[model samples]
Target: MKKIFKLSLPMLVIISNVSVGISQVNVDDRQSVENAKIVGQLHGLEGDTLTLSYWVNALGLDETSSYKRAFAPVEQKIIVAKDGSFSVRIPVYKKLQYFSLKSNRQKTIWKEEYFFRKGKMDDISTSASVPVLNWSYFILEPGDDIKVVLQHGQMSFSGTGAEKIKYLNEFKYSQNRPKSFQSFRGDSLSTIKRISYYDDLQQFGINILKKYHGRISPMAYQVLQADIIGHCQYYRYSSASLFNSYKDPTIRRIYLNIYKEQVKAKALPLLEQLSTEVLGLSKSYPLFWQQRFKVEQSYLLYNAHGDGVETQQASKNDLFEAVLNLKKGLLKDKLIVMNCSDMLKVFGQVQVEERLATALTELQDPTMYAVVKRFRDDFSKGQLTYDFTMEDVEGNHVRLSDFRGKVVFVDIWFTGCGGCVSVAKAMRDKVEPHFEGKDDVVFLSISIDKDKRMWKNSITKDAKRDPKLSYQRPGAHYSGDKTIYLRTLNGSDDPFIKKYVTNAYPTLMLIDREGKVFAFSAQRPDGGKAKLLIDQINDVRKL
Candidate 1:
């Protein structure tokens, strides 16, 4: 069985099992940590010196363990008391919280995360209200109280009124129309559309769009029209609405294009449009939270793929240039907080490389310092490559180099790797059928230990024989020797692995065939939302 570290613990109990130096893993099946209200005191213990400090979980449980703290950025957070005597509680039906650890001192440790799960209210020993937390195990000596709360604790999910699905229509009236265009002005309408994607009232500004596209895609594409101010009120609102789905690039492009056009078209309102659209994109895709858990669990084995603190901080410098250039607040923080990935990947591509040099001039950029720390490494010398290759069960001779012109999903696995097998099986059931004929991409699994006979035997035991997944990797390798495709190369032969070394089993490396370096790597290939993978593949198609 695969060990799922990043999961909702439906086995609720607010069970904060301590493992001396390891982190606390909170399990929840439904809701976020914000839903599980908490009020607590954080402490630190080194040699029996107990010190109380300010902390916050004012909204949820503080599940950060020693290992968990390594994966998250270091800021203020509720610390379990030193000496390991901390009050821990979990309210029934509460929202789970997710966060990683960081430090102001040493380099950022990437694989530490805290995910709290929900359980029944009557099952726990504490009162329903938030409880006081005083933990002791590791040594943390500061308070981490949040300055303000962004969300509140919900008493129930099945309640009526504001909590009910019916309450969405109320947001329909909150739209602030672009400054110049009159809603009724037919001459100002450049394009009209109806989208099925919008069904929420919280993004009420889009009500105008739905009203316009009464037919056609009124089902998927909610109405969003650009006005003189270049701001598509509906687009701005929809980006923040939880109803927004991740698969739609046509929509993300519309927002991106609108931002570009407004700036090019000249505007007293360009900043306003860019502000709404740019920050909105981050809200739509919270990349920071997306990989937090994986890093928390496997940082030493995986790559977090970004600069250190300063680099992380400077990257968000231009997110909402118009608004952030003028002022700083939640908008700025949200832009920097949520979009740490795009700042390095997609946005990095669009930027001038020298801008990185300029960002380094700031003296506080953690990226340059990080680069200096690894300056002798392969990435600095431009020697990095995704050099490893593997054959599929069909004996297709699929190498990472073979997919050089397109995007490649490189599954680094062995026959006995349960997580790897589970993900491949999942792809067959949950996703592969959805894209039955997509030939634009290729998926390959590379075995580290070279054993062709063992490989074939394992394939027979797995693909042809598994019952729980009901997945048969039908076709090649099974019919004859020609049916099985297997490639094996030790990490020693692969320069890519040598550059950024790793030892984790069943690692997933998403690579670009064009450049052939690793795009993203994960240990739990199928655990969380597949949006990150979906987004990368979609991005390639757009190119």
Candidate 2:
């Protein structure tokens, strides 16, 4: 079935511990080991280097189309021996946590989530042949241990809690198989049919859970039940795929024209049913409030678009009324902030800033009000660009502030991103030639490719290419003139890139000479708006 209630788990690498000549811990003997922390050992790794990254979910700001919510993740990374036989202790939080094991040479990554109670040690062993290594068999006792055996494309788990883990894994595997829900097309499925399919799927999930209730933890069963119910409500009230397809204006308009009347007819009754269901569910569920707000926001956006009310055309009062109509609480406060942030992106910083200033007075939750204010203050124009030091192709360290007195156009990209590569080619052809000899303008290309070798290889290949485009220069890489500053993130997460909220690859930015941000998100070099870079440079010079 289509994944119901997808979890937002951001992978954050924390630390790396490499050990040699370390003795592997036997799973049978781990029961006697102190259960102070979670310890893991991997067996048959193919590569010389293995990376373990741990991620913890934190309540921070998450922005979607300029709307901020409360969800962020902190990650830490650790490197282990490639022999796949190293042991390390990981600190455990009170809540659930997630980690990943990545083989650099094999190009394989295994990710899994687990709950680590105090004084618990998790012993894991897997080989290169293991189809899955993460969370396959986890012994949950304070000091319990488990072993996973993978051979000939088959996997088996053994340990104190093996039965429970095996049952859970089998149930999850069955649920993940391709189902009819995956083929349900948004445009083809009627609203009633869509609702019916989701309801049927939800009932199926509940039945499965009931069948296996005695075999799983009560907490796990409750969480899964809540997730199933929330997903059903979300899909029934708001067409899942239809909401996502709104990114393309043409598709959005077409779907609206075809389904507007039907949606108008059925939306209220569906929403009413959803509201009643959400109100009946306890507040302890993770998706309880989130689901309600999601349905409400989706409904509002659906009606607004159908009525041809563009965000720009909608006044601040209109936005306020939309938010005010929602039930007052944390959800309403968050929705208000989200609406204001959306306005900020649509109506420019000044207008949205004023709107938020007015909203703070009416907002009940001080934390959300502070979050909105902080977003406004941080994203305002003229703020100093976040500085970062990255390694260039020649191994020279380049700091963003080094070009403080020159207008810098930064192209944030990676090696595998096709869009990023296309934009880079366009910049090299049409944009770079415009200021070939102008020392006041610098074109900076920063690659966030985690693989340093791949980054270097791509740069070397690009340097050799002499595209015969209209703006082709004598050499693609300036024949060693170093006109374009090429840098790599070098596997570390650069704060400078994150400061601009670069969720998309090939994010272009224009920084003014005074080390302040001119445009946090600029036009693509391949588009007609690419000329705006030059205009922005001229405008900054005049300032």
Candidate 3:
């Protein structure tokens, strides 16, 4: 039986608004070594090339956008000249930073399922492409100097903090597409239309900051009101599993009694503005305080497993008593170093050093205890793995520890992936005919395709497979059928696809036989898990 409730337990006791109207912009840690000047102009592209990144450190907003595949530790390319000017100065890592300038040949190569779709924008900039003539977020400071131009594709700005992001390049891109929510339409009409679709997107971003009040800059108007309440509480706790596939307890107590008689008293003051004093001005406040601490730790494990609430399972001492029922400062020390960087990426590093010894005195921010002790000295389990180098399809290169004593099974795909062609048609029908002739098993596959002719037309095709041109043709002769193709030699910026794909993909690893890592998310020969990926490659070839 499923009828689950706790749609984030009635917006969990309206967040104690730490007197909104956000603050924190004092600067001085030697103003991150001061510099900031960015003159611009690029009328007709001329000698091309442009880039101007930022985000030198917002500790990757305590990760969770499929662990944000690392990049942008400050970039800067530019080139342009032939009469269409350009200038650069950068360095201000503190007071009101955020930048982006684009057009390094309108680049676009990224896929962690496009960060949950629908025009994803934090003033645009994801695995690129969202700048019909760029310059996103753009709010500089230390020793200010601004001034930009662009022309045909229209973009402008002028001297010293030009009216703070000139209404973000003239706003109205249909207000970053909000207002969605309809799926499970019963549990109180999908819980009062998903709390009035995030209170009409926090009153349409406070009526566009009261129609551009004081022309925007009090910390870019609280980072656009914490990017409209962190995209309405990150799409309301990532659409809290819309009533976990409904189990009809009389149509869920008849629309949870019409959401406690017509939407629980005007939706608890629009879910008390999901406050935590919009912490240190927006990179959307730690992804809206890690989606409001995973919706109050899933309403404290659905009130501690009340009647088989989907087979309860939230350990690590139930995530340290649901973050010791939070209250302490700096957003509970940045959600205790983003709960030890999501418990060292799913319970590893000996369970985040045994919950950092009871989370080391509730970790009082020394930059969140040195960012969870640098994610516990960069977590490692079975270790070894990263001998990277890939490129096959004639350009040769290969290397993952030169398949040392085999047992590989890598996968990691791209180039129009329909779930990597349904796990390469379940590894060509039920796991390569059960490892027929396994010389210590291999399989491989890689890709992260940065267009080596679309990764050699998606692994050198075979024929007769057009489920509507299977995501740009893919039938999988992944290297003459049995699978062994490669390609990531710097494709998705390969540092072995950013240290084992945290910008996800069809990523499935395994390794063993001394090449180490026995599964950084393995098992996926599609639906009928191909005899559980052939019994986890025969239990990692019997270790």
**Number of clashing residue pairs in every model?**
54, 12, 1
Q: In terms of TM-score, how similar is model 3 to the real structure?
A: 0.30
TM-score of each: 0.29, 0.54, 0.30
Top lDDT prediction, candidate number? 3
Worst 10 residues of 3 by lDDT: 6-15
What is the lDDT, from 0 to 100, of the residue 125 in candidate 2? 34
lDDT string for model 1 (1-543, tens) is 322223332222333332211012232233333222232322222122222211111101123311121112212232344442333232322111222222111222122211212311111222232122112111111121221111232111121111211112222212342112111111111211111112122234345444434332211121122121112333323232211222254543343343334312332332234443233222122222222221222222212332122322232343424223423332333322222223332333224233333322322212112322231232221233545454565665455565567655655555555566676655554444444467666655455546555555555523454343323242212212212234564432344443332334455555554644444343232555455556655665555
Q: What lDDT does the true structure give each of the candidates?
A: 0.32, 0.48, 0.58
Write one digit per residue (lDDT tens) for candidate 3, span 1-543: 221111111010111212110011111243235777777787877666666555533423222344443222345466778887877776665556666666655635332211122322122333746434466555666777778787886667888777666655554344363534443433444555565567676676567566777765565666666666665656555444233335554543453344335433334343345455445446555555565454445445545654346521343446556665777655566556556545443443355566765565676434444444434443455777778777787988879888799888888788777777788777877888778788899888888767676566567665444443434664453533677788876777677766666445677777888988776667676767689779978988997
In angstroms, the error of model 1 at 391 is 5.1
lDDT of 2 by residue, 61-128 (tens): 11121121222222234454454443434432322222334444442433332212233323343334
Quality of model 1 by C-alpha lDDT? 0.32
Best by TM-score: 2
Ten-residue stretch with the least lDDT total in model 1: 180-189
